[model samples]
Each structure stands twice: as C-alpha cells, then as structure tokens.
Target: MFSFEDYREILRLVKESGRYATYGEALEREEFIIMRHDVEYSVDRAYALSRVEDSMDFRSNYFFQWTNNSYNILSRKNRDLLTDMHERGHMIGLHFALNGMTDMELIRRRIRQEMDMLSDMLGFAVNTFSIHRPSPAVLAENIKLPGILNAYQDEFFSFDPKAGPDSALRVKYLSDANHIWRYGYPDAETIAAHPRIQILAHPFAWTKKGYENEENYRTLIREKYAEMIDSIDGECKDFSPYREGFMGMLT
Candidate 1:
C-alpha cells in the first residue's frame, strides 16, 4: 500500500498462492485471484507498479481514466507508457467515470463509447472497465455489457442493496481505496481462503519511501505542477521561453 517493495510482497504472495489469474483468464477458472490496478492519479505510478509486477513475471489489469483531470491519457507520453505495458503482457482497461448519471442503459451506452474510443486511440481493444468511484446505486445496478466485462458485475463484485445481509459473495472483493485496506487486507491467509478474489489497488498512493496520506498528496501536487508546466509549454510556443523559471523548482 505504501512502498514498491510492499506492493511487491503482496504480488509475491498472490503468485505463490497458485490461485492468481487475470480477468480474462478468470473466465475459464473457478479458483482465481485477479489483480486490478485503477490508475487514479498518475499513469507513471501505474507504470512503475506494472514494472514491479513484470519483474516478478506477473501480469495484472490496469484501468485508466480517459476523463481524469489529473492526467491526460491521450497524451503521447502516456500513450507510450500504456503501449509498453500492453506489450509486456499487462492488460489495459478503461477506468470509467459515471459523471453523475445512474441510468443503467445510459451507463452501458457511454461505457461502450468510451471503451471504443480508448481502444481506437491505443490501437488495442479495451474489453473491460472499472468504475472510478461508484455510488451505491451504481453498485446495486450491477451493470454488464454484451461483450465487455464490468469489474462491478456480480461475478467479480458481489453487491445487492435490497438483499441486505442475505446477499452472499461469489467472488471475494478487496480494495486499497483511500489508501486503506477497505475489505480486510489481503494477507497470506485471506488469499489462501478465497478461491475467487478481485483486488483493486491504486498505484498513486504508493511510493518508494511509503509516505503517509498527507505526504503522498504533497508529492502528487509537485508532480502535477511539473505536468502542468510541460502541458503549457507543449500547447503554447510563448510559454517555452519562461518554462525554465518554474521547472527549476521541481526538484
């Protein structure tokens, strides 16, 4: 949750469990633990984690937001990183934003549209998506597209508002949302117990030093400043002349 080594430890634990599987691979297996990373803040951070997994010969799903204000997924630098991840056998999926609308049909339509657009942009079919930060209503809806895999679907995500406590899980779900282990940290024993598991980890919260939440945001803000400076320099010729003044403080 904090350090890259910490993340690697979890990856190692999952791999050694002999139950690890990708989402697509899960389609054929009953005992599978699918590792998912939602690119919440930085694709760079996501790519770093991807590299960590790659070093261990592990592949996981990485979902990126097309509409995120923090990072531009369509940017050339990001596209290159994404392509590299895909080339290395990592799955790139869409991190969808509902934008406040909860209509099931409309959500379905928009997901397809975004996936198709992202797929076209990346030159690879994005066959899956994970909701950015879902509302309870969205979870209850349990949306599923014809050919696309919804990360929140009943198969992977078990949720039923009306069913209340009676609703049982088909696949155990765990998340490092808000930089905390929401559904009991996926420890060694937990991983061994659950046959079908889906883990959602955000790459942005982790760093080499394992900074605290406040420290993490400060780091992200500094990164954002560098990104904005580059963005302006790229978009406007005049900005380049004065770009050095701000860029100098990045370190």
Candidate 2:
C-alpha cells in the first residue's frame, strides 16, 4: 500500500532523479504511457482516481468488479454515473474474479455476461479488463497467455502479470482485502521501487487530518472529486496503447 506521502515522494524522486529520463525516452520513443487501476470492491476509489486523472490531465483504464456491496447493478444512479463517465472519455473495464472458473466455457460465458452488463450500462462494449486476487505465480504465467474474453473490444484489456516472465518492476503489495493505496504502510517505498506499474486500490474507509475521521474522509473525497473535475477541465492527454494489448515496461 502507498500513502499520499509515498506518492508525493515518488513524484519528488521522479522529478529530481535522472532515472525518469529513460522512462521519458521510452514514452516518447514508444509513443505511449501507462496509468492503470483495478477497482475491486467499490467505485469509491474509481471516483477518487478519476479525480487524480482529471487533476493530472491524464486518462487511464479503470477495472471495476460486480458483486454485492461492490457495485450493485440495480442502482440506476450508479449505472448512469458510470455511463456518464464513459461518455466523458474514460475507459470502463471489467475487473473479473475468475479463480473459480474451472471450466473454460464457463469462464468465457461469465466474462461475456459481465462485459455485456457493464458495456450496456456505459452504452458501449468494454475492451479492457484486470483480474481480482489472481496469485502472483498465476499472474506471472498469464502475462503472455491468451484467453477468450468475449464481449470485449480488445483482448489486451486483460491485465495479467502472471502470464509473463519475472519482472524487477513488480513488487510485493501487502494490502487490505480490497486493494487501495495506504501511505501508512512502511513498505510502500520498497513496493514503489518496482518498475511494474502497480495500482493502489483503496475503499473509502474514512479519512483524517491526523487519523481516521469519517466526516473528514467524506469531505476529502468530495473535495478530491471536485478537484479532479477541475483538473480535467484544464488539460488532458490520452496515453492508451496504440497496439491492442501492449503497454511498455521500463525495463
């Protein structure tokens, strides 16, 4: 988990250290960038990151899951909001939990259903996806593997670290049940050093000027949302990949 301070420090380091030169060079040479987040349990973080993206004038894919208390498909408000976000120019993707899909047919079918539901709500078929809770060993093996993610616009939307070889950039992320960035965690610096673009997911668990405070947390969330919208209003750059499933790793 990465705290706000941790991200700030990373920003500072990237700005000060020349290490980013290579990364920047790669971005220019490759003509692309990376910004990904897996929205597992709730859209709270999705909303937060939307703000962050809006602030930075950046747009990235956000994978959201469907389950009780996670994202109630029954909520018309939620559906409309998600759709509006899509119309506003953000990628709405599936965050699949397929660990129990022993049957390949079942896996594809489930994926289709999820994609259809999300896509329909957003008035378009989603092409991108990221898994929830797939083990690292599995992830590494999956990085390069292929699968049928029916109803998606692109197969590359699937984010799998397991399908490929080991990476220096990927690091251990000790986290709460739902992935969220935690600055309070001590190992954030170590995890941040990894080159793999790791997403920090967090539920809206309350915020604090000093410690956990629900009211203040809610306020911060509101403020951040407003800030994010304002940020997007200023300027934005699209960094989605040109090739369907390719995003460069700073190796």
Query: Highest TM-score, which number?
Result: 1
lDDT of each: 0.86, 0.46
Scanning candidate 2 in windows of ten residues, the lowest lDDT window is 242-251
Off by over 4 Å in 2: 1-33, 135-196, 203-251
By TM-score, how accurate is candidate 2? 0.52
lDDT of 2 at 38: 61
- Which lDDT tens digits does candidate 2 get at residues 189-213? 6434444233333434322222244
**Candidate 2: lDDT over CA atoms?**
0.46
